[model samples]
Target: MKIAVIDAQGAGLGKTVIKKIRKEIGLNIHITALGTNPTATSNMLKAGANHGLTGENSICNFCNTNSLDSIIGPIGIICSGGIKGEITSSISQSVFNLNCTKYIIPMQKHGIYIPGTINLKIKNIIEEIVSDIKKNIEKLS
Candidate 1:
């Protein structure tokens, strides 16, 4: 499956999510890292993303047309304004607008709100997503 992970600043749980997905599932999956900046994208790439893209065109390029099976990130992945302005309504709308399936993680316990996060109940949500994907894949095979 192709999974797109959007991290606006790489400060949130994107890295952790990627690590868990790789270690726990141990499956050959395509992970795309979409970062607001190169650093965020690189961090996820290091974590395990097979491909990484960042910056303005990067957002416009993949946010809409990319055929990702799923997108995982914090609620802010859709935030429409701020530094670099990469994360905009179009980007958020594209993701929120994706006809494809998606898995969105909520904020941390403190409700402090990170720029981009895709796991709220991180462990449980990821487990559920992985479980469902595995089941669907097995059925398809």
Candidate 2:
């Protein structure tokens, strides 16, 4: 499956998510790291993603042309004005409208609170994401 992981800024979250996905899911899956900046994309690629793209254009273009099995990212990504405005309206809207399943990391930040996700640790949330991806990997091929 082609799984896109979107992140911006430091991309520490994307790196961690990619690392876990690589180690846990192995080579059978192809991961695409889509970052708002080059640094974020570089970091995620270093974490073992099969491919990486940088910028809002890349994100929007991919969303427009690709048929993905799943898109995984922080909830912040779907917010139109997130990541200090690096994530544009087009990017947010495209991702928000993707026909594929979306696996979002629920969290409270930037005055936004994901309902029912209070007190959930980031590590625990990541583990759950990996588990969910693993369960769905069999359908990839």
Best by TM-score: 2
On a 0 to 100 scale, what is the lDDT of residue 60 in model 2?
Answer: 95
Off by over 4 Å in 2: 139-141
Error of 1 at 24 (Å): 2.4
Candidate 1: segments with Cα more than 4 A from true spot:
82-86, 108-120
Worst 10-residue lDDT window for candidate 1 reads 109-118
> Model 2, 1-141: lDDT tens per residue?
778999999889899998988888888888899999999999999999899988988899999999998888888788888877777899999899899989888757656786778989988998998898877876554
Q: RMSD to the native, candidate 1?
A: 4.3
Candidate lDDT scores, in order, read 0.73, 0.87
Worst 10 residues of 2 by lDDT: 106-115
TM-score for each candidate, following the candidate numbering: 0.79, 0.93
Give the CA lDDT, 0 to 100, for residue 86 in model 2.
72
